[model samples]
Target chain A: MTIATATMTSKQRMLAALDGRLPDRLPVTTHHLMPYFLDKYMNGITDQAFFDYFDMDAYVWTVPHRHDPSQGEYPDPEQGEIGFLESRRVSTDDWRVYWEKLPGYEYQTVRYRFVTPKGTLSMVIQSNEHTAWVAEYLIKNKRDIDLLGEYMTAPKCDVEAVNRTAEEFGERGLVRGHICCFDVFGQPGCWQDAACLMKVEDLIYATYDDPEWVHELLKILQRRKMIYIQSLQGARFDIHELGGGSASSTVISPKIFEKFVAPYDKELIAAAHHAGQRITYHTCGGMMPLLELIADMGPDAMETFTPPGMGADVNLAEAKRRIGDRVCMIGGFDQFHYLIDCAPEDTRAEVRRCFEEAGANGRYILSPSDHFFDADPELIRAFADEARRCSYR
Target chain B: MTDLEDLRQSIIEGDMKSTTSLVESALADGLEPGTILNDGMIAAMTEVGRRFEEGEYFVPEMLIAARAMQAGLKILKPKLVDSGTKPLGTVAIGTVKGDLHDIGKSLVAMMLEGAGFEIMDLGVDVPPEKFVEAIRGGAQVIAMSALLTTTMPNMRATVEAVKQAGLRDQSVIVIGGAPVTQAYANEIGADAYAPDASAAVRVTRSLIS
Candidate 1:
C-alpha cells in the first residue's frame, strides 16, 4: 500500500482510474454542492471550492449552447434587475425567473413560473440544491405535442465555447459536459421526456388512449438527443451522464424499462461509446433490481447507491460481488442520517463499512449516496478524514 | 359470478374486463356493496400491495391493478354510498412547496385509496395553510412528499402548522419522497415515513390503527 500526499493532479488520478490503471491513492469525490453547507457557512463561496476544500477529484460541468438571440425570446423584467442572468415573471407564457435575498441564508430564491397548455405551474428555490423543478410546460396536450413536433427548434452547438471551458478545466481537473434537458418537466428522452412534456397523470391516460402518439413523441426527443450526441464530437468530457433512475429497473417494471427506456438509451450509449465517451447511469433510487439491466446498458459508472435501510435495497457487498468488475460504483455512504448531526464515531464506522464492502475491489469511490442538505461540521470532517484512512494496496 | 371468489380470480389474472364486468354484475344481482368492496376490491388491492412489497410485482403492474381497483370502485361507490359504507380513514396528501415531482405522491395516494382511505389530494405546491385546512376538514393523516432537499423543510413547517392548529395529536403526520428518510421524518416531527407506495399503505394502516 502506498501512503501518498496530494501530489498528482485531480484529472490525472481520475483518468488513470477510468482507464483501469492504478493511481497513487483512491480518488475521493463528491457528486454535488451541499446547499446547506454553502448557504450557512461558506457565505457564497465559489463553485470551485466544492473540490478544493475536500481535496477530491473535481467534476466540472460545461453547458454549451448556441442561441440565436433574435430567434430566442428574452424577457425584460419590469420589476427587478434585467439582464441574461436576471429574470421576471411573465403572466402569459409561464417561463419566468426572479431572485430574492433572504436575511440569514446567503443564497437568493430563484422563482420560475412555467405556463403550459394544461395549466400554469411555479417553483421557488433558494439554492441549487432545491433548484426549481417545473411541473407543467407549454406542451401538455396532443395538439401541443404536434406543435413541439413542428416548431421546436434544435439547440445549435457551441463547440468552441465548450472546448474553451474544457481547456480551462483540463489544467485543474476533469471537464464533464452534459446534455441540456429540453425543459425541467421531464427526461431528455424516452418515457420521462414524454411525461415531462405532457403531465404524468395525463400521460398515463395517453398511454392507454393513444400509445402510437406517445411513441412518436418519444422518438422525436430521442432523435434530438441523437443529434446532440453527434455534436459532442471533439468535446473532452471524461464521462457524460444519461438515463435517470425514474427509468431504472426499480422505478418502473422491467416491461416499461425495456419497452421505453432500454430501446432509447441502448442506441444513445452505443453512440456515445462509438464517439469515444463513457456514460454514467444516475440512478438515485433502488438499483439492486436493475443492476444487471443497467450494466447491460453499458454505463461506465453507476451513482447514488441508496442503502437498503433508505428505501432502495443497495447491499454494497452484493453490488460489488455482482457487477463491481463491470463498472465503477460511485456512491454508497448512508448520507440520510449518518452524515447529518450524527456521532463522529458512527460516521467513521459507516465509511469503513463502505470501504470493506466496495473498496476491496478496484472500482469503488466514496460519496454520499445522494446529496445532503445541512450537516454537522464535525460529521463532514469525519467523512473526509475517515475516507482518507482507507488505503489501496 | 359476482361472488368474492370470482372477483378475486378476475383481479389475480389482471382481467380488467372481467373485473369491471363482475362489479357491474354484482350490483345488478343485489349483492351487498360492502361485501363487494371489503371482500372483493380491497382484497385485490391487499393482494396487490403484498405482491408489490415482496417484489413479485412492479410499478406498471401495480398501476394496472390500481386502475382495475378504481374501475371496480366506480361500480361499487354509488351502491356503497346508498348502503352507508364508511371509509377506514381520510388522508390529505400533496407534494410540498417548491417540488414539482408527483409520481411518488400519485402512487402513494393510489395505494392509500386502495387500502380504503379516502384521499383529499391537495395537488402540488401545497403551502402550510392548505395542510391545516385539510386537517380541519377531518383528515386523519397529513402526508407531505418532496423530491428535493430544498422542499424538505416544507414538511417540517406543515407538521408545525398542524400542531399550531392544535390538530397534531388528532392527526398523524407522514412524509415520503426520493430524498426523505426515517431520520428526517423524526427530525421534522413526522409520525411516520414510508419509502415507497406499498410501505406507505402499511405505514398508514399502522398509524391509523
Candidate 2:
C-alpha cells in the first residue's frame, strides 16, 4: 500500500523505506565489500564500483574524526597503511604504544603495550588478510579499566568534514557512519564495546559475578559514545548503526539484553534522533528472541536478520509479522548458500522469497543476511537483478 | 543431602561463591570427592545443558554456569586426584588456524572439562600441526572450531594434516563453530559435528566411549 508509482533514487528509496514506506522496488545493498573480495575477484575495484557492478542500493560510508591534539596526540609514527575500519593509531604521551612482533605464530601477531601513568595495559592481537581479533584483552586485571576510562581519548566527529562529503556526494547514495567506539578495537554499542575490551566469556561472567562492576565498565563506555553522539549537531548522515552481534540472543540471553544491552543503547538511540539523524539497530546474529526487545528501543530501522542456517535464529516471516510495522527491516537473504556455489536461479529465488515474506507491506530492504567474505560475482549480479524486478505494485 | 542439592542449585544458577562453598562443605562433611563431583558439579552441568538445548538458557548462562561448575571442580579436583579418579577422556581443542574466534571453542572446552574430560586447550589461531602434536602427545580427541567460512577450510586442512602425519586413526576429530555444519563435517571427513556446546559434550562422550 505504500509503494510509489515511479522509480526512486537510492537515497529517496532508502529514505522512503526507512520511514516505513515502499518505493518502486526493493532497496538491495551489501554490507562492507571486503577488500579481499575486491582485490582477488574484481581487480581492486572501488567500493562504489562494487555497488554499480551489482547495481545495488549503495551506502557511502564516511567517518571523519579527530583526537585531542592538546594531549600530545599524533598518529603512531611506526604504523603502516590502515585497513578496513581502522583509523590511524591516536597516540598521546601518556598513551604510547610499544609493539613487539612475536616469533612463531600462525597469523600476524603483535603484542601491544599502552604505557600510562597508573601503569601499563597490554593486549595482543592477530590478523590475517581478511579480519582481526583480540588475542590478549587489554583489561587484564579487574581495575585495569581505570587506565582506559581515565586516559583514553574519545574521537571527535568532524562535523564540517561530514557535511562536506554529503554535499559532494549529493544523492548518489546515503551517507553513513556509526556511534564512536573504544579507541583500539570496539563496536558502537556500549556493551559490545565492553565485550571487545574484555573477552565475551569473562564479561558474561562479570554480569553474574559482579553486576555492579559490569555496570561501571558499561557506563564508562556509554559515556564515551555519548560524547561522540552529542557532537553531531548536523552531520547529514542518512542513518547511523547502533548495536552489535554480542548483544544477539545467540550469544546472550534476553535477560542480559534487557538488563545490560537495552538500557544503555536506548538512551543513545534517543540522542541520535535528537541530533536530527536516523538510527538502525544492527544485531547481526540470532534476532528472533530480541525482535520485540530491540524494536521497543525505537530505532528508525533494524538490520542483519541472520537466519538459523548461519547459526542464528531469525524467522523472517515471523519477524515481519511481529515488528515489521514498527521499524524498517533490512537484510535477510542467506549469502552463504545463495551467493556462493549455487546457481543464479537460487539467488533470484531467495530474493523473491524475501520480497514475498517481509517486503509485502514495504519498509523492507533485501540484503545479504550479514557480511560475507566470499561469494560469486555472477550470483551477486543475479541477487541485484532479481531484487530490482521485485515490484511492490 | 540438603547441601548437595544446594550445590546443584548454585551451579545451575551460576553462583560461583556458593558453588565453591557448597563443594568445600560437602568435602568437609566426609562425602567422597567423586561423589561430590558426580552429585554436585556434573549433575548441575547436565541440567544446564538440558536447559540450553531446550532454549531456557543461552551462551552467557551456559558460560556462567560452566564457570560455577569449574569453581566447584577446582575445589574437588585435588581431593578427586587423591581418591584416584580418572577423567572420561583427553580432548585437545582450539579455534583453527587463521580464525581467532575462540569464545565458542572455549565454551566447548569448558563443557568437555565439566564432563570429566582432561582438556589440552591449544587456544586461538591454532595451526593443524599443534593439533597433530596434541595427538602424538596422547590426546585422544582433536576438536577444532572456526567462526568464518574463510577460516572453515582450515578444519579440512587439519583433517588432511592428521592423515598426512599418519595419526589419523589415533585421534577422533570433532569440528564445529558458527559457519560449520553437518554437511561440512562430512565433506571434511570429520568424525562428528556438534551444533552447540551442550551437544558437544554428548557428541564427545559418544565418540570417545
Per lDDT, the best of the predicted structures is 2
Which candidate gets the maximum TM-score versus the true structure? 2
Q: Candidate 1 — which residues are off by over 4 angstroms?
A: A1-3, A34-37, A67-129, A183-189, A201-210, A376-378, B3-6, B9-18, B97-99, B183-190
What DockQ does candidate 2 have relative to the true complex? Answer: 0.71
Off by over 4 Å in 2: A1-6, A67-82, A88-106, A110-120, B1-3
TM-score, candidate 2, chain B alone: 0.97
Can you give the lDDT of residue A364 in candidate 1? 74
Please give, for residues A195-260, the per-residue lDDT of candidate 2 as tens digits. Answer: 889888888888877899999899889887887888788788898889987898878999999999
Model 1 chain B lowest lDDT segment of ten? B8-17
TM-score of candidate 1 chain A against the true chain A: 0.80
> What are the candidates' individual DockQ scores?
0.42, 0.71
Candidate 1 residue lDDT tens string, A50-98: 5676566677766555544565533324335432212121222323333
Error of 2 at A33 (Å): 0.9
Q: TM-score per candidate, in order?
A: 0.84, 0.94
Go through the candidates in order and give each one's C-alpha lDDT.
0.71, 0.86
lDDT of 1 by residue, B45-141 (tens): 8898888888888776777677777778877888888999999899999999766678788888987887899999998778899999998899999
How many clashes does the backbone of model 1 have? Answer: 4
